[model samples]
Target: MPPERDQSTNPTGRQKSCARCVKSKRRCDLTQPSCLRCTRQHFTCSYPSRPAFNAIPVAEDNSPMPDSSIDNVASPFDMSLIQGHRNTSVQSRQDTCLLDLDVNAGLESIGILHDLRNTSPMPENQQTIIRSIRVPQAGECRWELTPSSYARISYAIDRMKQAPATMVLENQTPWSHPLLYEDCMPRVLQEAHATCALYLARNETNSAFFARHVIDRVKELTSSPPPTAPLDILARAHALILYQAINAFSGDLQLNAHVCPTFPHLEESIYALYASLQSSETPPSPTLISLYPATTARQAWRAFILRESSQRTLLILCQFMILLHLLQGRSYCFDHACVTSKITTSAHLWNAGSTIEFASAWNEKRHFLVADLDFSEVLEGAGPEDIDVFGRMILVTILGRDDMLGWFAERGGVF
Candidate 1:
């Protein structure tokens, strides 16, 4: 029987040669990326994805034969050991040594795997044998073409690069929540925002898509009944605030430019949310105060972070609601008086290492008693830097209200 072919050898025969060289049967000096022979001739040079099956390892279990036995065996192909022909009938070692010398002459003459060919009239070793024939096997495997690991790492890096920009904080004090997010928020809410930010960072690709991501997150927060966890409510409120802040910045910066029309009601909806107590809905949405319904000092202390985040978010909304009414004659959920009584802190207070520290600090300092929000003081007495987002919205409210007053004054200063 003809000796089995070694599937390890290059099957294309012309794999190392340039396309022109293979066609013309000329020697090719294979080079990387491209070859010299092809470059010099102005022809495209490329290597096959798998140049040869030398890639597959031989069965390590096989023992090597003596040197005297090596020369008689002219081809590595004759050994049924070539992984490709696993189903071929096994033969005595001597019979499989039958390499077709005439078959391998071209590869020998071409110096492909140079050591495989005869250097002298008498060969000294089996390692001296030249590989020539490439067997076509039932099944051949090659490197997988799926997206590489590096691609995922690159994507994660890009998302993080955009994070610090999106997750900005108005106040950097330890008491201030990071990114205006009270650290006590539910992980689900944080993850939702992170997902939105990652998608939003791709704004360069599609501004509408980025806008939709943020819009969708807010929509989830405002579903009919609303979430019940104190942390969840705080997270929802924080998310609403963030959406408006992002919308305001994007509008001013024209980040979307002519590529997209302004997001429809992108932030108007956020102005519409209020803590359940101030909401006056048919049943009211949930709020931190209602969630625990506890009278103990410890529980109150535990609820402080939730209350702070909620108060900050709702109170900020109240100021914006006042501004919108004065400036654009628009109304939303939550009246100006709705959030008038909520307590807030002077510092954001994000420094605590854990919930216990926050509770301990809260019980000790009780900052809200002194720092409680007073909108009248904010509107009449405070300057631009006096408060936070709530304060900024108050300033917008005062300016808008004065503009209305000026319009009336132009018409003889009537009410």
Candidate 2:
């Protein structure tokens, strides 16, 4: 027979183990803060509140039980009694051991949960749980690059290295708005652009200084509080992408290491931005933008810009991550199937300098709405002139330059 356990050490005349220890059937030392078993296993240490004996119904007879009846009942400290009590309590409360585990750690492992929680509140009618943002998978399509395509990609990287120079000259690129003036640009984006330009311009004398500055700036941007507004989140996402592009392609091991940890922040920002887009009112369509009065058109155009910019930013980030994974000889993180958002294909429509210009382009240009990375309709319906730089880059990355050139040749356009 097992020896009876002593309860003298528990001055309150009650002995209860932590929830984790009880669940695992381990002996708990009953230490404060965390018990030895829980501490060793790195499990959360939480004790169930002792049930109020006074609240429990008492027998109608106040007299003590006879010795024969008392002998048949298990003691309070008996393991069997404890186990039965735990089972009864769990069943009554409709709770389980899983709920007692580390909730924060579980949330950290799955980033979408954290992002959904931090995202802007949706209307009560629209409130719904966002479980995940589907990442692109590799098996959906053939993403292999031929040697010629690889060479073209190398040239593209070289151009990317030189891009900061153009930014320094105030030249608009695929990602920047042609009509957006310097004063109106977000301060965070401006800082990101300036940092990229300075980092690229760094020579032997200032190389170390610029390297440290870039690293510190990236860390600061990523570690700061997340932005609440959709546009602000978009700006922060764009800035992080700039920093990621520089570090991922810079061929600097130290820089890559420093920036790799911030990839989750970029991803979370994208999630928050995407959630905001989905929850808020849908922007005016291109056709509708043309019908509105000039003032209303301008307002509608700005809304279109915000929506388009967010989608484009997501596409660009997805493409960049795939390219980065390929460069590092890692499996693709996102595949073609992941890109379901529609993108505007017409350069004229995307780059319109004013509301009137946008309407003109919308009415005159033969644009394509490319979705799910399927460019077949685009290839057949649109000429080289119709596709913007951003669209071209996406096509080249997915279809390879050889195919892109073939399409260009078919349209009697130069590659």
Candidate 3:
């Protein structure tokens, strides 16, 4: 053997820079990868500093060094030891790290997460991250693109924003349920009606109670009365009553109990509502309308019934029912329209906190009532054709008729 090459004179150059040098600045040297500088700085020597985006950063810190001389190395990514300027207390670091990681991980990580979420083998709780990207196709919607439908939808959405009665009464004195509700109802009803009227009139100056488009429907309904249907009359009556109620709330007390007491069946109800309104010592002012706008269905209905019903308890009941329907996403528009048409501009009708409080109470009761009502006893006699799909579903679900519920649930709302 030609003078066996001195093992110590081995050729492969040692890592010139320690792992820390390569990581902090993308540079390399021929000396032992963990070079003198890295050893002095006490950093794990690593090679090939710049890894591909997804390739885990070199885990060289965990590897044992040949010379057990250097103090144990730690991961630079260890946030606990990070010397950044941000004041990250232990409580905030976790949240801060997640947000930072989410941002720094780049779009590719997002795509991976998105894909993982969709193809997840885990159950729903773990799979909740999957998001449905809605790709709309022309002419694929459920409703026709008719003006009436638009008006109906807009009016319905507007109605959904009304306040609740108990919310309207929370700050009032003595806090008796019946008295507070009774005292406030007429004004609330009047407010709802005024809102509906201004909404019907397309008078932005008045208040945007009903959708401006609703005026178009009002024109149509008033121009050509649906002579064949009593429901049309009911619609008109509601519209008119709401209009009158708004005027009443705005201090236009022209509509006394003596006025056409709304529709035929509700004459007594209307009078009672009017009487309660008139009894108010301060009486709601037009200025109040300007201050508190009745923008939701709940607010509208509560205002109207609270103002209009002599029986304050009934107002509470109606509020409960409407709220339940809203939460269930059934009959939302109808209740909304009914409420909005009555209270949009009537501020004296309700106050926000009280309205919310009442709504909360009603919600608590609603679940119990829904549970207690015998589902078997609901409309046993209506023919299949008599109820529309939406109507039938509501009727069945609300009434608790098992057969109807089953039939409607199976059939769904359809032609």
Best by TM-score: 2
Candidate 1 stretches greater than 4 Å from native: 1-176, 179-188, 199-203, 218-225, 252-301, 324-336, 348-415
Cα-lDDT of candidate 2 = 0.55
* Ordering by TM-score: 2, 1, 3
TM-score of 2: 0.61
Q: Per-residue lDDT tens digits of candidate 3, residues 1-415?
A: 0011112233332333334544444232223534322332334656444322333233234433232111211211122222222334422321121111111001121111111112324343322221221211221111111222222222222222222222233322111122333433333334444444444344435443343333333344345533332222223334443433232222222322212222222332232332333344433422222122424434534443334322322222233233222221112111111111121111122222455443433333221111112222223433344342223322332322444446555555332
How would you encode candidate 2's per-residue C-alpha lDDT over 1-415 as one tens digit per residue? 0011124333355667788766654445565667544543346789756443334233343543233121232321122221122333312221111112121111222121121132345445532332232222321111123344354455345445555555566545565554443337677778888987787677879877877887888878877888887767877877787777667656555566654466577667656666676668874474645455688667766766766777777766655554443343222332112234567778887878788988777777777776545667877788878887777776665455677889899999887
lDDT of each: 0.36, 0.55, 0.28
Taking the candidates one at a time, how many backbone clashes does each contain? 9, 3, 45
Where does model 2 exceed 4 Å of error?
A: 1-163, 180-183, 286-293, 334-338
- By summed lDDT, the worst window of 10 consecutive residues in model 3 runs over 98-107
Q: Write the per-residue lDDT of candidate 1 for residues 1-415, one digit (tens) a residue.
A: 1112224444644334456556645444345555433443334666545543444444443444323232232331221221123222433332222111111112222111122223345333322222221221221111111122112122222322333244542222111255344434465456556744554455566776766766666556555354554445555544544544454335423322311122223233232334344453232212222222234433544455445555555544443332222111111222123334354433223344454554444444323332223334333432332234333322223333344345345555332
Ranking under lDDT, best-scoring first?
Answer: 2, 1, 3
TM agreement with the true structure for every prediction? 0.35, 0.61, 0.19
